[model samples]
Target: MLLLLLLQQLLLLLRLLLLMLLLLMLLLLLLLLLLQLLILLQQLLILLLLLLLPLLLILLLLVLQLLQLLQQLLLLLLLLSLLLLLMLLLLLLLLLLQLLLLQQLIILLLLLLMLLLLMLLLLLLLLQLLLLLLQLLILLLLLLLPLLLILLLLLLLLLLLLQLLLLLQQQLLPQLLVVLVLLLHCYCFYYYS
Candidate 1:
């Protein structure tokens, strides 16, 4: 009887060991599944970043281009303002000359009217440029090409007007040569700048 009871107890212990081993194997499998899930998540995150990186770079480049355009526009504004001031000075000088020269009153009056028209045109051009710049800020890449063409055309018109003024000045008086030359220099500087 004693030997039989000892054999039964050993059998129970072996069965318990088997149950524990099965539990351990199940736990290991759970741990492996968790590790695989973590690895997959990490890979997905890397892929997302890779996909977004180029778009982010493109946005950054666009912002930099906008900044450069704004700077150029500001410079153009400054030049236009300077030109306006110079025109005002020339108008004042012409007025003084008109007062002193009674014999050439008719010619001086015509020149004065032309200069006034030119000043008004310049004012209109400045306003148009400002409007175009505002549009550029809003429209960005879509309007960029057309804005450039418009600016070029405006500059050409300005050059033509300047040439006309120079011709008039040459016909009117040699004394105005110095002022017209200065004006030409300013226009050249603005063009190069």
Candidate 2:
């Protein structure tokens, strides 16, 4: 009985260890997911930086063209042309900035779509891991079934042996006594001769 109790405790401990391993695997998967998210965020930031380079170059060219045009203007038309040029430059800057914003929006939309796709892929991988865990659990159970059956058979055999001993005490004791008496008589007869 004590041995059986100890065996049950050992089985419980093994189950707890398996559960801990499962928890660790889940935590590792979460860490992997977080790392993937960080990587995606970094990629989108890089794409945004790359997209901004052309807009910066366009601004620099516009500034240089304005400087060259200013040097060619006369003092008489300077005041009038200065106001017109300022207005035109402001309008052009606003238009260019709007276009840049639109392009950024389109890039952001693309990034969002890519993020969605990545998330879907991650979800599929997680599902696959879960399925593998379930399969492992089923296999472990299958392996344990024969061991359980064997233990049950051993317990039944032990019970049968105990019952057989009880039967001997109750029904075979008198026959055993008669055999011992016969053996004792033969030994005495041989000793006398």
Candidate 3:
């Protein structure tokens, strides 16, 4: 009984340790998620810097054309700036789409991780159940041991009884043979007389 109690306490401690480890893993995953978000933010800042480049170039071009007082070049510069603006807009749109896709991917990855955690928890639960089943089997064997011993004793007693019956049969058969000879002798004497 004391040993059983110790085993149960040990199992409890093990369960607590596993739970703590799981919690630590979850914390680490959360930290990784935060780091990824920081990286994504840094990438966004870099993209924003890239987005400003065309506007700055267009401004510099306009300032140069104004300083030179060139009318024909001014019109060309305006058209060039308009084209750059349109390209910038398309680039921005594509970047936005890419960012949306990345966010979705990140969300999917997080969901997958959560599913993996759940699976791990289920596996732990199954392991605990298997341990409990093993304990129950051990207890059942302990319970059955005395009953098995009793059954064996009963079998031995039955074998002894069978032996005794065989001995009785052996003795009775000889006695019956002797009585038959005596009866035969009596019959012969009466016939002779």
Candidate 4:
């Protein structure tokens, strides 16, 4: 009877050991499945990131192109404005040159009128003085005839000298060359800027 009771206890222990081994195997299977699912989730996230990278690069490229176009447009506008300013400056220069020419012409006209008046006054005075001398010579003909003849020759010589002086003009080629050089220098300055 005792042997039979011992055999029953051994069989119960064996059954309990077999049940524990089965539960361990099931736990291991569940852990392996959970690990595979985690790996798949990681792969899916990596694929999503890969698909989005090219789109982000394309957006960045578009933005850069837009910025470049804006920069070129701004540069073109600046150049156009500068060209307009240059045209305005050239027009102003032309107007200034016209005004200067008009002023110079007016001054020349005034100078010509003053010289003419001076020559006329000198001639009138010389004629009046000669008439007075002739009257004196008539009053004392014997003493003053030779003196009056010499004075008449001197008067003729003086008139010839005044005529020669009046015909001569001041030289102005040097001043004109200086003005041309200054205009060229100003043009170069603006072109380089």
Candidate 5:
């Protein structure tokens, strides 16, 4: 009766040990799955960066083109202003030469009005340039938004991975210790018997 009871107890201990081993294996499998998920996330991040690279380059090119166009427009405006100033000086000379001629005065007035119109057109061009600059700023913001979102996602994943690792450590260490103690107890029991 004593031997039978001892044998039953030993069997129970063996079953407990097997259950602990199975639990450990399940935990390890879960860790593997988490690691795989982390790897997949990293790969996805790399792919996203790769996809964004071309778009970033295109945006940079567009911004460069816009800047170049703005510079050209500014040069044109400067040339136009210089031409208007030269025309004004020439008209003043003509006015002095034909002070008694009404036709000459009338033509000078028309030329002055045209210069004002040109100035207004320059202002409109400047406004258009401002609008283009605003559009470029908006495009830059749009581009940065996705990058920010991706960074946030990566940070979240890292935090989750850390938490998982900490939880695994907390849960696994004590369980491993228990398993080792049980194994030692079984070994001692067998030796003593």
Candidate 6:
């Protein structure tokens, strides 16, 4: 009966040792898979940056083009206003030659002055519109700045994590290898004995 119990305990120890080795192998595999996942994430992030570069550049070009077009429109409006003023002046000179009454002359002059004031108001409104556009551009830059900074930070951190995982492998790999060798040796001795 004592021999049987000793035999059972021996079997149990061998079984437990085998279970431990299996668990260690599984743990090692899982750790390796995690390392691979982190590496994949890093590669994907790099690819995204490469793809996004051209898109960001195109957006910047579009903004510059918009600003240029706005300036050209403002110039055209100013030129048009100048042409209208010259035409009005010519008409008034004609009226003078045609012996228009003093009262009519006064009315024409007042009308021209009112038109000038309206043009000035329109110019002010256009200036305000331009200011608003500038403000919007600044706001967009402000928003984009943080996002770009965050992406940069994330990339940096991921790189650091990859290095850390490598370091962990360097530190623990030999120990795990030793443990596996020792367990195999013990199992072999037990089977032979």
- Number of the top candidate by TM-score? 1
Task: Please report the TM-score between candidate 5 and the true structure.
Answer: 0.52
Error of 3 at 36 (Å): 2.0
For candidate 3, the lDDT comes to 0.59
Candidate 2 local accuracy as lDDT?
A: 0.59
Off by over 4 Å in 4: 101-193
TM-score, structure 4 vs. true? 0.42
Q: What is the TM-score of each candidate against the true structure?
A: 0.55, 0.36, 0.32, 0.42, 0.52, 0.51
Residues forming the 10-long window of minimal summed lDDT in candidate 5: 184-193
lDDT of 5 by residue, 1-193 (tens): 9999999999978867766675676567567656765775686678667766766776676677678667866876786787679678867866765776657666767678767867887787678678667766766776676677667667766776786577657765666676566667656666654
lDDT against the true structure, per candidate, is 0.64, 0.59, 0.59, 0.57, 0.70, 0.70
Question: Per-residue lDDT tens digits of candidate 2, residues 88-183?
Answer: 665565567577776666555655665675566557656655755665565556556556655765675566567656755765565456555545
Model 1: how far residue 167 lies from native, Å: 83
Model 1 RMSD vs true structure: 34.8
* lDDT by residue (tens digit), candidate 3, 1-193: 9999999899777766655665565556556556655665576567556645654565565456445444534544565566567556655655775777766665556556656755665576566557556655655565565456557656755665676457546754454455555455545544553
Stretch of 10 with least lDDT, candidate 3: 65-74
**Candidate number that wins on lDDT, 4 or 5:** 5
- Winner of 3 and 5 under lDDT: 5
> For model 2, how many clashes?
0
Local error of candidate 3 at residue 78 (angstroms) = 28
Output the better candidate (2/4) by TM-score.
4
